[model samples]
Target: MRVDLFDFELPPERIALRPVRPRDSARMLVVEGGAAPFADRRVSDLPSLLRAGDVLVFNDTRVIPAQLEGRRGEASIGATLHKRIDLRRWQAFVRNAKRLKPGDRIDFPQGVTAIAEERHADGSFTLAFGGEEPVEVLLERAGTMPLPPYIAGKRPTDAQDREDYQTMFAREDGAVAAPTAALHFTPELLAALAEAGIASETLTLHVGAGTFLPVKAEDTEAHAMHSEWGRIDAATADRLNAARAAGGRVIAVGTTSLRLLESAAGEDKVIRPFEGDTAIFITPGYRFRAIDGLMTNFHLPKSTLFMLVSALMGLERMQAAYAHAIANEYRFYSYGDSSLLIP
Candidate 1:
């Protein structure tokens, strides 16, 4: 399919710069399968919207401050770590690629520094940190939250983004980006879900900076998705299968979770233990295996995420739904409003 088919006009003001206060107060647009009318609701209404025995799978991968600004011999350089290659080495996208070469040391704040090692064909570099201290500690001292360019381009990142970008379920540390759909969940909403008997589980998918990359491909078939690490243990997979066997629906809290779940499921639709990288590029005509529904934030035009949703529903359905969202003033992108897609 042509990538242009997914394109839509979005007013700049509709892009969200920050999350709403209390988290759950953010509006949610419920889009059902087929020709059902779109329903406007709040994130807090999830407990009532969902039935008992339905499970909401959340991504527990924590966002690391992967954005770094440094200098090499007076030449300014910017880097966003994309994936972990080793305990001390990472593959990163560089801003000043022309100025960097193999073996050049970039000096960051707090004496934290890294050496540019091998450069990839895509112009990314292998960054190896220089220190005995854990790389996490080095990042904490010198790195800042990796906000999506849509929001960061409008305003500077601050201390507020540190907490706002993270979800309550964040634990495992590896992701460069937060599973923004989960950002709308709060303790109060969890309590309500528990009281309502709507079960929730967690999986891990270390979201990379590739999520923010634009689809420059003219056709959807030409687009290649960057891999991201994810995991689903035996116990969790067994539980999810058991829930489904009992006629319960498995709802993914974010596309990261849905992608990971689909990666773990078999052709028979049984989820199994999985641990590795997944570069699943979900587009229209793809068959969903593990998840029954999805709760995610609004996505960018012509993005892989929009393609995924279009697959779950249909191309025409998603196009119309997005039109309604934009017309209704629903916030867009990470740190934006939520949507519950039931297809």
Candidate 2:
């Protein structure tokens, strides 16, 4: 399908710059077959909406404060870690790429320094940190949360965003972006879901900086997905398969969870344990085997994420949904409202 098919008018002012207070206070729009698929509900009502036998799968990957400011000689540079290649090497994007060359030494906070080892064709460079402390620990001291460009313009990340941008279940650290769907879930809400007889499991998928990168391809099919490391453990797989055997639904908490599940699916549609980098691209003709439903935040217009949702909800339906969301003053994007798409 043409990428333009996913295009819709989203008012710039409607983009959410901050999360709603109490997190779960966000709105949820349910799009299921039958009727017009226009239901008004709160995110807090999620537990009650799902059936007893359903299994909720969430991405436990935590966002890192990967955005850092540093100086190369006298030139100041803004850097964001794209992904870690190993203990020391990382692929990163630098703001002043034109002035940076391979073998340039940059000093970070806490006296940590790195040497640019290689330059990629896209202007991103590889950096190898020189330190004994874990790179993550170093980043914690030197970096700030990597907010999307849209949100960054509105305000700087204060104490509120330090907690608000991440999910309550975030554990394994790597993602630069938050799984916005999981942002709406609270500990109390998870407990309520458990009390309602719904089971939950977690998989880790370190969302990459590429997620926010705009699609340069005019045709959707021409686009290539950025690789992000992900894993589904044996325990989670067993529980998910068991849920399927018992005729239970598998509800993915976000697109990250959905992509991980789909990437690890076996021949029988049962997910298996998987640990590797995945660059799986899901466009309109992609058949989903593992996820039954998706819980995701509203996405940008003409984005790959928009295409992924269209694959499940149908392009025309999603276009209509976005129009409704806009007309009703629903918040949009990372810190925005959510939707439950049952395909």
Candidate 3:
């Protein structure tokens, strides 16, 4: 499909500068099958919407403070590490690329330095840090949360983002972006789901910084997906299969979780424990596996995520749903209102 087909006009004011006062208080738009528009509701109403024995799969990868600012002599560079290639090597996006020559040293505030080793065709760089220890340790000491680009002005990382960008079940650290659908759940909400007999399971998909990058290609098929490390352990896989055997629906909490589960499914759509990198791109016409329903945040127009939802609910229906969300004054993008795709 042409990438332009996903384009839509969104008012700048609709961008959610801050999350809702109570996270679960955000609005949720429900789109079932190839249905008419959407039925609007609040996120807190999720428990009532789901049936007993339904398995809600969540991405439990924690967001890291991966945005690092550094300099090469008098030149400034904005650095964001997307993934760890190894213990000492990382793939990163570096701004002011022309100012830094290969082998030039870039220093961070918390005593981290990156030596630019090579540049990729997409303008990102391969960086190698000196010294023997792992880079994860250095990152924990030096980096700041990689906030979405829409957030304006210079600001320090504060108490709120530290909590808001993370999910209640977040455990492993790697993702630069949060699996936003998981953000709607609070400890209280999780308990409520449990009491209601809704089973919860977790998988890890360290969301990559590529989620923020725009689709530069004119055709959807031409767009290359950025691979992110993910895993569904053996135990979680077993429980998910058991839930399905009992006639339970598998509800993915976000596109991240959906992508990981779909990537790990076998021919019969049964999920298996998987540990690897995936660059799976779900566009319209793609067949789904292991996801019966999805709870997710609103997405940007012309984004890969928009295409993922379009794949689930059909393009026209998704367009109408997005239009309804906009007309109804629902917030858009990360840290925004959510939607449930029953289809």
Candidate 4:
């Protein structure tokens, strides 16, 4: 389909610069599969909106401070580490890349340095740290939170972003971007869901910087999704399958979780143990075999995420739902309001 079909005009003011004081206080737009009136709700109302037998799958991948400002000779350079190829090497998108070349040394703050080992066709570089210290340690010494350009361009990343950009379930670190929908969840909301008998499970999908990349493709067929590492253990897969066997709905809390689930699920709709990379590009006309519903943040116009949601709920319905969200002053983007899309 034409990428222009997904385009819409969004007012700039609707982009959320920061999260609400209490995370669960954010607004949620409830969009049902059919022609039901869109419901204005709150994140705290999730328990009430979902049934007792339903399960919510969360992405537990933690956001790393992947943004780095450094210098090579006289040229200033910026890098956002998106993927880990090994213990010491990372795939990063580099700014001022024209000034860099293979084997060039870049010095970052706190005495951290790396060699620009190779440049890929996609314009990213393979950066290998120049110390025995773990890459995670090097990042801690020199990196800042990798905020989405939409937000970072508006304001500088600060100490507050270190806390705000992480979800309650964050544990296994790797992701450059936060699974924004999961950020709306809090301990109180978890307690409520537990009391309501709504089960929660976790999977990992290190959301990469590619999530923030714009879809420059004129058609959906031309868009290539960047691969991200993900994992689903056998125990978790068994539990999810059992839940579905018991007539429970498997609701993915974010597109990250949904994509990983779909990647692991077979044509028969059974989820298996998986630990590898997934570059699943979900678009309209795709068959969803794993998730019964999704909870995610408002996405950018003509973004792959919007296309994923459109696939789940139909293009026209999502377009109308987004129109309602905009008209009602709902927040947009990574730090924006949530939406419960059931299809």
Candidate 5:
């Protein structure tokens, strides 16, 4: 389908600069797979929205401070680590590429430095951090949280974003981007959800910097989807399968979790142990096998995320729902409000 089909008008004011106080207080637009008018709710109200037997799947991948500002021979450069190749080397999208070359050593803040070992065909570089210690330590000292460009371009990432960007379930660091939908979850909310008998589980999908890249293709078929590493352990898979066997709805808390679940699931809809990369590009006409519903944030116009949601619901329905969201003053983007999409 033409990428233009997913386009929608969104005013600049709707873009969230920061998260609402008391994370669970953010607004949630409840869109069911029905003709019912969209319901306005709060993130805290998630427990009341589903049955006790339903399961909420969350992404546990932690966000790393992957955004770096550095210099190579007096030329200012910026890099966002995209994927990890090994213990010390990372695939990164670099700014000021014209000034960098193979073997160039870039100096970052906190005495951290890396050598641009190779440039890939897609314009990213293989950066090998110069250190004997773990790269996470170096990042903690020198890097800032990798906020999406939609937010970062409007304002500088600050100390608040360090806390705001991470989900409560965040652990196992690797992701450059936070699974934003989970940002709405809080300890109190989790307690409430558990008390209400809404079960939850976690999987890991190291959301890469590539998630923020725009779809440059005119058609969905031409778009080159970026890959991210994900995992589902045997125990977790067994639990999820058992939940479904008991007639429970499997709800993915974010697209990251949804994608990984779909990638691990077989034609019979059984989820299995998985540990590898997934570049699943979900679009309309795609049949979902693993998830019964999704909880996600409002996405950018013409974005792959929007396309995925459209696939879960319908193109026309999502278009109408977004129009409703914008008109009702719902926040948008990474630090924005939440939406519970049931389709």
Candidate 6:
């Protein structure tokens, strides 16, 4: 389909710079399948919205302080580490990259530094950190949270974002970006979901900086998704399959979870154990073998995420839903309001 079909006007003020206090206070827009009227709700109402025995799959990948400002002599460079090739090395999108080349050393804060080992076709560099202190440790000392450009461009990332950007489920550390939808969940909400008999499970998908990239492709077919590492163990897969077999719905908490689940599901619709990288590009024509619903933040115009939601619900349905969201003043983007899309 033409990418232009997904385009819409969004007022700049609609973007959320920070989350509401007591995370669960954020508003949620419930969009049902077909011609159902869109419902205005709050994140705290999620448990009541979902049925008993439904499984909510969350991404447990933790966000690292991937944004680093450094210098090679007089040239200032900024790097956002998006993928980890190994313990000591990462693939990063570097600003001031025009001044860098393979084998240049960049000096960062806290005495941390890295060597630009290889430059990829996409202009990202493979950076190898110096010394033996774990890369996470170095990042803690030298880096700041990798805020989405939409937000970062508006203001600086302050200390508050360190906690606000992370979800309650964050555990495995690797993701450059946070699974923003999950950030709305709170301990109180978890207890409510449990009381409502709504089960939850976790998997890992290290969200990359690629999520922030604009879709320059004119058509959906031409767009290529960036690969991000994810994992689902045998036990989790078995549990998910069993839940589905028992008539429970599998609700992915974010596109990250939905994409990973779809990647692991066989044509038979059974999820299997999976590990490694995935560049799953979900478009309107794509068939969803897993996930009965999706809970995610509002996305950018003409973005792959909007395309994914359009695929989950029909294109016309999503277009209308988004129109309702905008008209109702729902926040947009990573730090925005939430939406529970059931199809």
What is the alpha-carbon lDDT of model 1 when measured against the actual structure?
A: 0.95
Q: How good is model 3 by TM-score?
A: 0.96
Q: Give stretches of model 2 more than 4 Å off.
A: none
Give the higher-TM-score candidate: 4 or 5: 4
Candidate 3 lDDT tens digits, 11-123: 88788877896878999999898545578999888889999999899998999888888888999988889987987888898889889777888988767888998888888
Worst 10 residues of 2 by lDDT: 31-40
Question: Which residue runs does candidate 5 get wrong by more than 4 Å?
Answer: none
Task: Return the lDDT, model 4, position 241.
Answer: 97
**Pairs with backbone N, CA or C atoms under 3 Å apart (clashes), candidate 1:** none
40-110 per-residue lDDT for model 1 (tens digits) = 99999999999999999999999999999999998999999989998999999999889999999999899
Report the C-alpha lDDT of model 5 over 1-343, residue by residue, as the tens digit.
9999999999999999999989999999999886878999999999999888889999999999999999999899999998999999999999999999999999999899999999998899999999798999999999999999988888899998899999999999999999999999989999899998899999999999888889999999999988999999999999999999999999999999999999999999999999999999999999999999999999999999999999999999999999999999999999899999988
RMSD (Å) per prediction: 0.6, 1.1, 1.5, 0.5, 0.7, 0.7
CA-lDDT, candidates in order:
0.95, 0.89, 0.89, 0.96, 0.95, 0.95
| Candidate 1, poorest ten consecutive residues by summed lDDT | 29-38
What lDDT is reached at residue 339 by model 3? 96
Model 1 earns a TM-score of 0.99
Best by lDDT: 4
Residue 340, candidate 5: Cα error in Å is 0.8
Error of 6 at 193 (Å): 0.6
**Clash count, predicted structure 6:** 0
Better of 1 and 2 by lDDT: 1
